[model samples]
Target: MGHRLADTSSPARLAAPDEGIGRDELALATRNHGLPLEALRYDVTPPGLHYVLTHYDIPYVPDDTAWRLSVTGRVQRPLHLDLADLKGFPQVTTRVTLECAGNGRALLTPRPVSQPWLVEAVGTAEWTGVPLRLLLAAAGVDADAVDVVFTGADHGVERGVEQDYQRSLPIDVATGTEPEVLVAHAMNGAPLPPQHGRPLRLIVPGWYGMAHVKWLREVAVTDAPFTGFQQSVAYRLRQESGEEGEPVTRIVPRALLVPPGFPDFMSRARVVRPGTVPLEGRAWSGRAPVTRVDVSTDAGRTWREAELEPDDGRPWAWRRWHFGWTAAEGEYELSARATDAEGHTQPLQQPWNRGGFANNLVQRVPVLCLAKEG
Candidate 1:
């Protein structure tokens, strides 16, 4: 056998230039980012820092002639649409929060086995597009269809295996709802950047990032299950039983379980001296709108209800809340739980799975106490 590895540092890199945007800038953007709560019900999502989830290193901006969305598979009339054709329909927009199912995975203990993401991995944005249902209806989608498969223009190799990021939704998820779903061509208030699926992408709000396939190039309606790598092998939960089998690989709704008061989950480098710190965070749900957010400073022994903001649009957006307590001189554990409108309360700990999908357990933060500043 030849040498197992070659010199590593000299390999070609397709990485984009720094673009003068550093991690600190991104962090600040995330920290200060705000959604127009009043605009949540509208179709236009607010422009900047709209949540983005992508599998490609850079967005592919195709020329107008090169951009085509194919509607094939089980349709009575197969259709191919260009950018102008999609724009001809009366455009609609809605302010929706697009969250990565893996958002906040870094906060889990034992590190929960996946991407190291902080709170910023998710975002809310107003997406404008032609409702996919309209297009599918125009093409006369078959009644026997089971799933809607979406593919994009980006492709690459991972672990020496060629793969392109794509996703599928159940027929119920794809065509059941009004404004049904979207083949989004615009994000926020501007044309999508080349790095952000300029021509088209899918915007299926409330589901995990996997549901919102980007760089959309094709839409196929099928009666059979889509068992591709991105769907079957990658974004699935692994069972601890260690049996050679496929785990349940579908999107399940999860709620953002925020405690009454914000607890710092980790040490802060910004604080020179520590004192009583005020805490605040946001809570949300997918199954139902969050009704009550509870806080527990004494490790779930005693609980208090935090003040909750009025409902924005029922179940589509997160409600913000606040909690405050005097910092005592010692180490403390802080935690939060959320209850949905249907009386579904968040669990203290969610079960762990192999692929670590949808881990929305109650959020806990560790805080430190310090002497009063002189």
Candidate 2:
């Protein structure tokens, strides 16, 4: 299926001033035209309405008839699978949440560096495709294979590096039984939008968005770890000026409280009547299932356990959580934190890294508890 381009007339496509746009201005422009940065605040983000953030301005639309996914490198039998060939495999469907590695970059204390994302860089979708392991197994991975590098059709010069978008994972993780990584061709039961990986994409369940290569065209098994710019430079977190911190992976445990939209202010900052209110949002983790979620009305000074919805059995999907709060006339800082099955909980304050990646700090929203009107 061919992909459709986003309407150029959208507010996000407004031209910059003659003086040229600064980082802040560019961020605002993109936010207006691109996906809303606060999309996860809703109960279920519709697939068609899901947020879209691309590294390159133009999205690649491949002709389905001519498109093929190549598997080469350290494989015993290299193979090229067309769209129909890929669909012919035993297919699986799953609901997985994907968050940008730099989801909270805008909230970092040292000011902005990369995309100024204020936590709206995530969404959950039902993905349908063939298991990546099936393809790797068919190709017969070499005994010495170490990493599987996934390459996208999109290409652009980022930070002076002219290259196609690519990222790699250890062979075991790429073909792991759990999380069920996929060479996805459909999102939410439909052919993926161009903004997403259209003809094909790799869905690395439970990992950050960067690991899920869009516009996928090639899957290469390498004997050595791939050191592509996206892997070696861009997505890796760094501390200080020169220290290589660590490669960012997995979705950190986190919970977001959907705010009651207040009049005359952002919906996220709402005024509520002094009474009992239902607090709801979604919580997720990459390492394990979200076992517990806590809500705090007075910041982090105290917290109470929130009820967790039953897991959907997809290890990669997020859980819906809810808490009931009795409010009084006052101003309060509401916050939510989630704990995963592995005993890891969202921190009140996430330490800053040079790249501002993986900021899973507990989300805090301001609320005004007002008396009932009339």
Among all candidates shown, the one with the greatest TM-score: 2
Off by over 4 Å in 2: 1-21, 24-44, 261-268
Instruction: Give me the displacement of residue 283 in model 1, in angstroms.
Output: 1.6
lDDT tens per residue, model 2, 94-173: 88888877776666676435566666667889999999999999999999999999989888766666678889999999
Provide TM-scores for the models. 0.75, 0.89
Tens digits of lDDT, candidate 1, 299-356: 6778788777786663455666667666666666666777876777766676555455
Best by lDDT: 2
Evaluated against the true structure, the overall lDDT of model 1 is: 0.62
